[model samples]
Target chain A: MPIIEVRNLSKTFVTKDATVQALKEINFEVEEGDIYGIIGMSGAGKSTLVRCLNYLEVPTQGTVIVEGHDLSKLSGAELRSLRSSIGMIFQGFNLLMQSKVIDNVMFPLLIHKVTKAEAKKKAEQLLDTVGLSDKAQAYPAQLSGGQRQRVAIARALAMDPKILLCDEATSALDPQTTQSILQLLKKINRETGITIVIITHQMSVVREICHNVAIVQSGEIVERGLVEDIFTHPQSRAAKQLVIEGKDPDEFAKEQEAKSKAVPILHESRKIRIVFGTQSSFEPVIANMILTVGVPVNILRASTMDVGGTARGDMILGLPADPASQEKIISYLKERGLAVEEVQ
Target chain B: MTANEINMILTGVWQTVYMTLVSTLFGYVLGLPWGIALTVTAKEGLHPNKVVYRILDIAANIMRSVPFLIMLILVMPLTMLIVGKTYGSTATVVPLVISAAPLIARMVESSLNEVDHGVIEAAQSVGATNFQIVTRVLIGEARVSLVSGATITIGTVLGYSAMAGTIGGGGLGDIAIRYGYYRYQADILWTTVILLVLLVQLFQAIGTLISVRMDKRHI
Candidate 1:
C-alpha cells in the first residue's frame, strides 16, 4: 500500500469579504521511500497541499490517509503522536533564537519525554550527522543560513520520523548552498529510508533530487508522473510551461511565438514541436522520413542540451501544407515513440 | 548630616525598597498568567477565542485607564479587607499590586506576542502540546523581553509607591513630604529626589544585566 494517500483534498480560506480556494480535490499517493516533488509557481497551493499531508492545514473536503490513519478523524492526542512520527522543515529554518543549536535539536526529543541526558546525547549525534557537532553551543543567529538549515534538519530527525515534509526548505539559500542542502537531504533519505515530500517553485530543485513530480497550478494538480517522463513529455499547458521555462527562457519565448503563429495557419500546415529524449537524439529519424516519404520539410528552430544527465532536444518542424501529409508525419513520429505535440 | 537624620533616611530607604520589591513580585505573580491567557486567547493565538480575549482585553484596559492615585483611593475598602489596614507600607502594597498587575499583564502580553509565529509552528510540528508551546516556546522564547518588561514594571511601581505617601503610606516619599514639603527643608527634598533617581538607576542596571545574561541571540 502507498505510505501516504490523499483523496479529493480541498481547502478554502474564508474571510469576511471573500473566500479563497487554495486547493481543489487534490488526489495523489506516495509510496515508501519516494522523494516526491510538488512543483508550482507561488500561490499555486503547493505549500498548502503539503501542509495538509501532515494535517497542519486541515483539508476543507476529503481525507488524508497517512499510514492508513485518517488525519481528520484522529483525536488531538493521536494526531500529535502521528505528527511526531512525521517530521517537517521550513524555508525559514525557525530555530529558537534563544536556544543553542544543540538544544534546538533536542527540542523534539524533549517534547517526546526523552530524558535530558538522553536527549542531549541524541542531539549531539544528530548534530554530528549534519556536520555541525562543533557548533552545537552556538545560537542560531550566529550561524550562516546554510548552517541554520542544517540545525533544522537535525531537529526534524530527532524523532526518527518515517516521513519528512520540506516546504521551500532551500528557497532562502544561494545556489551553492541549495545544492549542498539538497545533497544533505538526499543523504539522509538514503541512510534513513525516510520518504521526503518537497514543495518548491524552483523546477531545478525537483530536477536535482525528486524521483517523481506533480505540477500544481491554480489549486489543482495539472500533471504528474516520473520526473523523467514529465521533463521529456509535459502534456498540460502548465507542465509544458514549467518544463520549457526551466530549460531556457529565451528558447521558451521563441517556441511560444512560433506556436501562436502556427495556430492561425492550421488549415494549411500544422507546426509541430517534437521533444527528443537522450536516446532518440542520435537517430536520423527526421532525415529518413524526408528522404523516404518525398515530403518537403522546413525546420524553423532547434536546440538540444543535457538536462538532469539526459540529452533532450526541442525542435519546431514545418511540414508540407496538406492534411494528408501532416497526418502521416505525425503518425510516423508517434510510432517511433517520439513525444510530438502540435505547436498551436 | 546629623546621626538621627541619617538613621531616618536609612529606614526610609529600606521601606522604599521593600515596598517596591514586594509590590512587583505580587504584580507579576498575578499578571504573568493573565498576560499568557490574553496572548493565547487572542485572535491569532494558538487557541483563539474572541469572546475570552475581548472580555480580558476590556478588563485590562479598564484597569489600566484608572489613574494610579485615584485607584488607590477607590479600592481602599478592598485594601482594608486584604491587609487589615489602609495607611502603611503593607497597605500601600495592596493598591500598588492592584495597579501594577494590569500593567504587567499588558507588558507580558506584548512580550509573548513578539515571539515568532514560525517558531511556534516549528514547535507544534514536533508534537508540542498547547501548554508546552505556551510555557516552553512562547514564554521561554520571550524571556529576555519579559525580563525587560519586568524591569520597567518595577520602576513604575516604585514611582507609584512614592505617590502613596499622600495618604500616609510609609516610604521615602512620606519622609520627603514631612521633612521637605511640610517643613520646607529643601536639602531633605533634594536628597530624597537624588535617592529616588539612584534607586531607579540601580534597578535599571540590574535589569539590563540580567536580561543580557539571559539572552542567547548574541552569543
Candidate 2:
C-alpha cells in the first residue's frame, strides 16, 4: 500500500458572500520514498490539497489515508500526532524568528515530550545534514534565507517523519540556491528514503527532483504520471507547456518537434529524450541496421531549436507518434541496451 | 538646595521609587494575564470568544476612561474594606494598583497586538499548545514591547500618584504638592520638578535599552 493515499478529497470554504471550492475531488497515491510533486499555478489548490493531506485544512469530503490511517477520522490528540508524523516545510521557511536554530529544529521533538538531551542530539545531526551545523545558536533573522530554510527542513525532519510535504519550499529563493536546495532534498530522499511531496508552480523543480508529478489546475488534477514521462511526453497542455517553459531552447525545440506524442509508457519502459543537434543528427543512421524497426516512420511533432551557438538550431521530432509506432521506434532507437526516446 | 532639603528630597525619592515599583509590580501581576486574554480572545486570536472578549474590552475601557484621582476617591470605600483604612501608603497602594492595572493591561494588549502574525503562525506550526504558545512563544516574542509598555505604565502612574497626594499618599509627588504648591516653596517645587524629569528620563532610557537588547528580530 502507498504511504499516503488521497481519495476524492474536496474542500469548499464559505465566506459570508460566497463559497470557494478550493479542491475538487483530488485523488492520488504516494508510495514510500517516492518524491511525488504537485505542480500548479497559484490558486490551483495546491496549498489546499497539501494542507488537506495532513488535515491542516480539513477536507469537506473524501478520505486521506496516511500509513493506512484515515486523517479525516482522527480526533484532537490523534490529529496532532498525525501531523507530527508527516513533516512539512514552507516557502517562508516558517522558523520562529525569535527562536534559535537549535530550538527550531528541536521544536517537534519537544512537542512529543522527548528528553532535552535526546532532542538536542537529534537536532544537531539534522542540522548537520542540512549543512548548517555552525548555525545552531543563530536566530532565523541572523541567518540568510537559504540557511533559514535549511533550519526549517531540519526541524521538519526532527520527528523523523516518513513523509515530507514541501509547500513552495524554494519559490522565494534564487536559481543557484534553488539547485543546491534541490540537491539537499534529493540527498534527503536517497539517504532516508522518506516519501516527499513537493507543491510548486515551477516545473523545473519537478523535473529536477520529483520522480512523479500531478499537475493541478483549477482545483483538479489535470495530468498525473512519472517524472520522466511527464517531462518527455507530457499529456496535458499545461504539463507540456511547463516542461517546455522550464527547459533550454534546444530541449524545448526537441519537445516541440516531438510534439510530445503518445509514447504511452507502452509498459513502463525507462524513457529518455535524446535531442539531436547538428553534430548528432546522423547518429541514428549509424544504429538503424544494428537494431530492429517495429514500424514505418510517422512524424509525431518536430520543431527547430535556436540555442544561438555553433549548433545554431536543430530539427527536433517525436519519433513514434502513437501506440502503433512506439515499438518500431523503440527497437530501432535501442543501442548497446540504450533505450531512449529521441526528440530531435 | 540645602543639605537638609536634599536629605528630605532623597527620602521622598525613596518613597516615590517604592510607590512606583510596588504599584507597577502589582499592576503587572494583575494586568499581564488580563492583557494576554484580551489579545488571545479577540477576533484574530487563537481562541476567539466574542462575548468574553467584548466584556473584558468594555471593562478595560471603562476603567481606563476614569480619571485616576476620581477612581481613587470612588474606590475608597472598597479600598478601606480591603486595606482597613483610606489613609497612609498601605491604603494608597491599593488605589494606585487599581489605577494602573487597567492602564498597564491596555498597554500590554496593544503592544502584543502589534506583534507580527507570522511569529504566531510559526509557533503554531511547531505544534505548540495554546498555553505553551502564550507563555513560551507569544510572551517571549513580545517581551521587548511589553517592557516598553511597562516603562510607560510606571511613568504614567508616577504622574497619577501626585493627584493621590490629596489623600496623603506622601510620596515625592505628595511632597511636591504639599510643600511646593500648598506652601508656595518655589525652590522646593523646582526641585521636585527636576526630580520627576530625571525619573522620566531614567525610565525612558532604560526602557529603550532593554527593548532594543531583547528584540532579536531587531529590524
Q: What is the DockQ of each candidate?
A: 0.69, 0.30
Q: How much lDDT does each candidate structure score?
A: 0.89, 0.78
Model number with the top lDDT: 1
Q: For all candidates listed, what's the TM-score of chain B alone?
A: 0.97, 0.93
Q: Which parts of model 1 have CA positions greater than 4 angstroms off? A: A247-274, A281-336, A342-344
* Clash-forming residue pairs, model 2: A257-A301, A257-A302, A257-A303, A258-A318, A294-A328
What is the fnat of candidate 1? 0.72
Residue-by-residue lDDT tens digits, candidate 1, A1-344: 88899999999999999999999999999998999999887888999999898887889999999988999999999999999989999999999999899999999998889999999999999999999999999999899999999999999999999999999999899999999999999999899999999998887788888889998989999999898888777889877777755743334557878977775643645788788876676789899777766797888878774454466787879888888888888888888788887765
TM-score, candidate number 2: 0.82
Best by TM-score: 1
- Locate the minimum summed-lDDT window of 10 residues in model 1 chain A: A244-253
In the range B136-205, model 2's lDDT, one tens digit per residue, is 7677777888988998998987887766777787677877888888989989988888988898789889
Interface RMSD of each: 1.1, 2.4
Q: What is the lDDT for B163 in model 2?
A: 67
TM-score evaluated only on chain B, model 2? 0.93
